[model samples]
Target: MLPIRECVEQTSGYIPGEQPRTNDFIKLNTNENPYPPPLEIFEGLQQELTKVRLYPDPVSTQLRKAAAKVFGVSSVNILAGNGSDDILNIAVRTFVNPGETVTFLDLTYSLYETIARVHGASVIKIPTDNRFAINQPIICPKAKLIFIASPNPPVGKHLNRDYLEETCERATGIVLIDEAYADFSDENHLDFLNKYDNVIISRTMSKSYSIAGMRVGFGIASIPIIEQMNKVKDSYNLDRIAQLLGTNAFNFQEYFKVIWQKVRQTRSHLIESLKALDFLVFDSDSNFVFASSQWIPASELYKKLKERKILVRYFENPRIKDYVRISVGTDQEIARLLEVINEIKSGQEFT
Candidate 1:
């Protein structure tokens, strides 16, 4: 019998949200932005395709420089990846030894646990409070690396700035703050890099930037940390098209602003509507809302939505079993969802 590693044998890998091939459904299950990339991004990719015969710049220097300007960091301090997920894998490979521990929030992104397991590292899941506040104290002191997702997944609650600072101060291991949704939020911890050598902040172009299919994400950290991650990352992790498209997206900042404003507006309106329906909605700084319905179980609601060609995320885990995470779609799409909820409520008898 071919022998598999114990970690590989014991762990079930990360399962991404369903992407139904059918075009009829409104896809709100994955936290994808409901906008298209600016015209410039498409043009940039088209022009760059002429050069695809040659290998892309292995270092992705142009993209890194553009990202540096936007992030207010030196180019040396930024490292681009195929997506933020790639950077997470690279960080684990670079920092975590086989028997060491990697820690992240208990109910946060499910991918981190799988990444840790794949790297043959122990995982410590620190449970969040009822309000989805990360309990930083529970992280093992001897952990080799920690990954924290702000505006955490399934709940959409952010870690306070002070709490993040305290975590960095107390942790002996490297702390990676995954700020994939930072653009939707009012604040970010990028400045923490200047103060903490052990801190790294990862961002993605997938959410607020409306370029999920483009596969561009990056990390901002001290030069040394970036250097180590670079060593572990694949030489051609980012293709020429992604580099060109991402750089062009950064160039057209006004285009991003317009789309982001629309997303936030839709988010606010949806939150109000959900509240009107008597659902408990968490305060979100991301492109999605985490909500629980008193009248219906989340599983039942998810099925109902699916039947109507609308898809939202529902986790079976205890912490999030009662909730459904709904992504903010275009105004018409959201209105349609609200209408369905009202119909469901009207038809059902009281418990």
Candidate 2:
């Protein structure tokens, strides 16, 4: 038998959303931006090809500076990573001991539990209310780390701000807000950083900036927290290409703002369309909607959509088994999805 760490051997790793092999499908499974990145970001890449032979900037100074400028924080407060997953791994490693508790909301980002389990830390999943909101304080006295995904996945419900602030006040550990979807939300917990020393907000360029291919993410926290996380990070966490693209991506926020607006508009349309089809759709603050239909099983709906080459996410977990999470695509793509859904509702079967 192969020798592996007990934690790894015992764990069933996270199952990510589907990525179809062909480009012939309308993909709404993974919550990726449907739009292409700004053309300006690619203009200087050819000139940067020579620098790839050398090691990237160890500290990612310029990238951090650019991100800091956009986020309205000093460079000292920012720590860049290969992606927010890298940041989450680093945070779990830096703050938690082998058996220390790491807790997060149930049905949030599944990756949180996976990361903690892989690191040999104890994990606790707190149950949310029926609407996917947690009404009580999220406090674990024995915990060393707490991960909260704002506008959480599977269902794009935002965590209650009051409960979160109360959690920060009462908990004796680090509270890391995984804000990958914050760009699509109306509010965020950035203000918590000023009020609390143990708060960390992790952001990614994948969702809003349309740079998932670049694998760029940032950790925004106090200088002390940033310094510790930096120790656990790879020597060159952000490669030259990522740093260059990420820096340029931050500079083009005005251009992306228009795209964000478009996404919000599409998201509204998606919710209404799903409701019109009698799907029980949640009010989404993120760029996707969580919906379920009484007329059909979500798994069956998923298969039907896939048969037509239109994909969306369906979780097997019993609590949300009836629901499918659909990423907001461009107007035409969403229209096509609605059309197919209507056909399915009318009992039309596709071969």
Candidate 3:
């Protein structure tokens, strides 16, 4: 066997949420939209089938143009990727030198640190203010790149805008905002791209457009930054079928808006329902709820829920060990999950 680098050998890989490939589980561990995307996406697949024999456009041109029309930015300012994770990897490679520091909020996105490690860059894992209602900016003065999840993960709350404004004014390095869940949130940091040349706002069609299977994400940045990142990506990063589906989904904002509003309404109901059960539910700005309780241990609930074939995310990281993150599923799915919880409370035993 070939020898591996010490960093790669010792590092723990990023673990995505469980994906059981069966219909039996009420799956909500991953933050995916429960609604189907617009009908055009499926209809376009038949036409896209004809062009599979050829290579995809090295750079996704038409898709970027459609994205430009939707984002109200020039095509030059947008850079498409296989997924936002690809953009994160490209950002680290583009901005951070081999030994330079890449900083991000700890507990926000585990993949950020994993990608930094892959690039052989040093990582500075900063803490959220208080874990739950935490809001703070990256303070690593020497960092070459900073990735901020606007509506942070696990906790599912928006960052304090004042800190972001200060970051734009104070930070000397690149600022990348992960807006993967922003479509579900009422807040966004897109305006920062115009105000700061160092800022890059990344968006994904996975959650909002219900196209996670397509793997298309794009970044909003200063033209020069996008251009540099463009030079770092694979020639054919996004496939032809992805380009067609992504473009159609990007253009059909009305469909997304309707589905998103439904999810938001369901989110409010789920939060209240959980709170009424005496769980400590955090105020969510994203499409999931972060809740814990002194009465029932999250781990036990997670195990019991899994046994019953209902899946919600449980992070083993000590900081949030007591909390479980539940994705916003369809109204019927959420209702079923709540019913199971009531059953668990009534008689099911917990460790």
What are the lDDT figures for the candidates, one per model?
Answer: 0.87, 0.90, 0.86
Q: In TM-score terms, which candidate is top?
A: 2
CA lDDT for candidate 1: 0.87
**Candidate 3 regions off by >4 Å?**
1-4, 133-136, 348-351
TM-score of 3: 0.96
Pairs of residues at least 3 apart in sequence or in different chains that clash in candidate 1: none
Q: Which digits, one per residue and each the tens of the lDDT, describe model 2 over residues 1-25? A: 2223888888889998888889999
Superior by TM-score: candidate 1 or candidate 2:
2
- Model 1 lDDT per residue over 1-351, tens place: 112387888888888889998899988889899988877677756667788789999989999999999999999999899899998999999999887889888778889999888778888888788888865553469789989998788667678777788889888989999999878877788889989999989999998777888899998899899999989999899988888888888988888888888888999999999999989998788899999999899999999999999999988888789999999999989999999999888877653
For every model in order, what is the number of clashing pairs?
0, 0, 0
Q: Return the top candidate by lDDT.
A: 2
By TM-score, how accurate is candidate 1? 0.96
lDDT score for residue 163 of model 2 = 89
What is the lDDT ranking, best to worst?
A: 2, 1, 3
State the lDDT of candidate 3 residue by residue for 1-351, as single tens digits.
112376677668999898998889998899989999868766668878998999998889999999999888999999999989989988988998777888888668899988888677788887766564345555778889988897888778888898888877778899899999998888898888778889999999888989998899998899899989998998899999999999888778888999999999999999999998778898887889999855679999999899999999998888889999999999999999999888887664443
TM-scores, one per candidate:
0.96, 0.97, 0.96
